[model samples]
Target: MSEPVTLRVLGTSVTLLESIRQRAEEELGIRLVYEIHNVQQAQRIAVMQPERYDLYDQWFHNVDFVWPAGAIQPIDIRRIALWDEINDLPKRGRLHTSDKLGAGSLPSERLFVQHDGKLGSQPTERISMLPLTHNADSFAYRPERLPDTLAATEESWSWLINEGWCGHIALQSDAAIGALDAALALQAAGLARFENLGNLRLDEIDQLADLLIKKQHHGHFAAFWSDDQEAGRLMLDPAVSIQSLWSPTLMQLHRAGIQYRLAVPKEGYRAWFGGLSLSRRAEGRVKDAAYAYLNWWLSGWPGAVMARQGFYISNPPRARDYLSAAEWDYWYDGKPAREELPGSDGLPLIDSGERREGGSYAQRMGHISVWNSVMDEHNYLVRRWNDFLRARKAA
Candidate 1:
């Protein structure tokens, strides 16, 4: 008897679940190994050693870095068993024509493998990655921690940088995503403006750094976190009043009994779509297993699991079948939960009568102010951002 093929996957913990690994190994007859790292470390590995992973599970914005490095092979659209069922958002860039293409790398923008050997939005047989889970994200806060004056006003991104919240606030630490979060807060507070929030220029990057440094001097932040666990721990600190957050972290907070409100910011939420890409080094049997894993993600079960955790999967309707009518109604349809709903961990997290803060998947997805992005001036932004990270609080 032949040994099962061992397929190595590299990504952040966001989607690298032990359950998924177990099921894939059991169902696909392959030994699936996951190298889970923080987003920054995972990207470094993806670029520094593309041969190390058979499949890369990451966000579309990563194409900005990974594609140019020739780390991943374009997936053949024809080979995707349910390609036709995939929604228009990733393919055409919006769910509806009127839907705004939020600033950054839309799945469509870098999806296709053009004739010139570059990725583009044009329809093509080859795609950079297989679109999988996505979500619209915003900051979470304790309503009791908010002052009455601020509580009365509609929620806004400016709250992150609001002087009133200084010394009680936090931010995501990743330059690619956190910089955009900071930019939105800065723009909302009238502190700075930009031509494209998704693609910051060098001067604009410095402008943000200058302002952020001043804020640091004033002790504006309680923390800056780089991963989900850190973000959740920061949220637990009474000193951390408000911070940009991902859905899973929010859900974990709820489970911990904090009931932190995920703000529907007036400026809209930051959005991101994550997917799987075949490694350039994968070939023959290993490559087949890689494609199998990609296809397996969209096969309804995993999408249903992500859906439970507040992510919308590409081809949601397919995943919908795997969920109960009430689950679909609450998670995707934006209706109140008719009964207590278990989170991805199979524990009850969303209580009965709870409605998703941003309403239905369509409503939430429609309000993206920006997508998680790797800006044109990303490297310079990182250098300055790191400097800010290392800076001391003002006396």
Candidate 2:
């Protein structure tokens, strides 16, 4: 008997879950070896060691990092079974003409593999990555922890760095994302401004980093988390009244006790699109398995799982078939959940009559203010971010 083909899948906790692996292995009759890491570490491994993985499931922005290193090969849309079903959001970078089309590395900016062998937006037969699960992200807050004065006001990103919430806030620790979150807060507070919030220049990075370090010195931030689980536990800390959280973390908080309000910040969401890429080294049967996995994501079930966690799949209508009408209405249509909805654990996550915070899919996505990005000065930004992370107090 032949041994099962084993494909090494690398990604963060967001997509590389044990259940998904089990289901895929069962359904596809292939062995999957998953290597889950924090976003930064996963990208580093993907860029520096392409040989380590057959399938790279990560942020679309990561194509900027891996493509330059010749780490990942282009994906042929012809091989993707449902490529045409994928909405314009990823293919063109906006779902509607009115969509904000936020700054930074939008999927459309670098999705296609151009004639010059470069990642560009030009229509091409090949793409750098296969669009996967994506989401609009914002901070979560314990409404009970908020003082009535602030509670009565509109939700805004400023609360993350404002003096009133000082000593009781937390933020994600990824250099690119954390810096943007801080920049959003700083800009909201009227302390800093930028021409493009997504790609901060060196001066802007320094300004944001310095202000974050000073805030750290003053004990404005209670803690920082790099992973979804870490963010979950951080939110449980009494000191952390508000924190940037992903869908998984929000779900984690929901199951632990009360559901944290997924904030509809007046400033808009920090949006991100995740995708799957094939390692340059992948070939033959191994590459076949990789494509099978990518195609599987758009088939229905996997997308439904992601939708249940508050993410929007690349092909929404297919996932809609797998989800109940209640779920589609609650999640995509932005209508109130008509019935209780189960989470990954098959336990109630959403109660009846609870409207999604940002309204429908189009409404939420249209309001994106920025996308997770890798700026041209990424190295310097990373350095400053690390220095800020290591600072015990302001210099």
Candidate 3:
């Protein structure tokens, strides 16, 4: 007579939750119905219709404006065993009072890290969301197009802006401001100085204006993508050559038998993370079930599954316990085009570490950047970018 316990989670696909639900039911003896909602819809439900969703899965960042608006609960996970497996426990704790674990098994997600230095060793209190999984940003290039004896090294960031490749590559239309951000980092670190921060400044119109001018004079951009799929299409063409890319997008291309390399440019890797959080109203069995699900996901198996697929895990050591040597080599050093990327049977291997029987991967990296007072300038950045794009188009 009563409705089945509906665990409405905002974010992720229905298929993902179905897997979790099946596991929870079989492993934890809990029968639950699951529903998936989009991030935008989840935000509105969290604020306007609190009763709608029992959970929310999404990303937390300096530029994303949803969390501060009271759209989700900050979880408390200090007592949870899985929290110990996460490298960035303090930072994740700070974001969501209720989010305490990663979602699914994946290798690329080892541990979480944040180099704020301001927090010292204190446990984070103003929680918003827990990291479900994370990924890094890297360059995707066709080896055939690059000159022999390429000089880009992974230790520095300057190799990306070489004048020779200026117009030939495709840059993200939405992420154009990131180029300027990288340039600013160069100035901040006293590595290399670039004048006219105006060019680097995040003014949308200004960025558009600059790009338009460049397009007229250079005819360099092979193509521009509004989303990752479009970018992947360009990469598969081979004729399009190189582009700034996120590893997940590259993974999809790799699965399709595409040949591309993760550039070890002079600059270090660029990346971001996302996580899961509970609704403020969730309690009792639902909460307990969620916690159980969270713990199983982070303890190694799921973490390794995600990592070997391209996205680097936040907890590497834990994932290593689950992933095999071959899987590890394939992810860390092996190229998908050069070898067959193992799959989870017929599935796309959405989470690769799942293939590992008892793998565990841990985290790496010392610092993470989240939305904070100093990094809260994305509004200005976005506005400036719009201006840059508009101006560039006119030019």
lDDT by residue for model 3 (77-182), tens: 6645766566644343322344323221111221221144121223554344555566535456766666444544332333344444555566565532244434
Q: Quote the positional error of residue 108 for candidate 1 in Å.
A: 1.1
Off by over 4 Å in 1: none
For candidate 1, the lDDT comes to 0.90
Ranking by lDDT: 1, 2, 3
Give the per-residue lDDT digits (tens) of candidate 1, residues 1-395.
Answer: 98899999999889998888998899999999999999999999998799899999999999888899998888998889999999988988889889888887778899899999998999999999899999999999988889666967899999998888879998999999898899999999898989998889999999999899888988898899988889999999888989999888976698688957999999888999999988899999999998888888889999889988889999998898889988999999999999999888878888999999999988999999999988877889999999888777966
Q: Candidate 2 at residue 178, lDDT?
A: 84
What candidate 2 gets wrong by more than 4 Å, as runs, is none
TM-score of each predicted structure versus truth: 0.98, 0.97, 0.65
Clashes of each: 0, 0, 101
lDDT per residue for candidate 2 within 63-128, as digits (tens), equals 889999999999999999999999998889999987778988799999999999988788898999
Among these predictions, the greatest TM-score belongs to 1
Q: How far in Å is the alpha carbon of 392 misplaced in model 2?
A: 2.0
TM-score ranking, best first: 1, 2, 3
- At residue 70, what lDDT does model 3 achieve? 46
The clash tally of candidate 2 reads 0
Kindly indicate the candidate among 1 and 3 with the higher TM-score.
1
lDDT of 2 at 51: 93
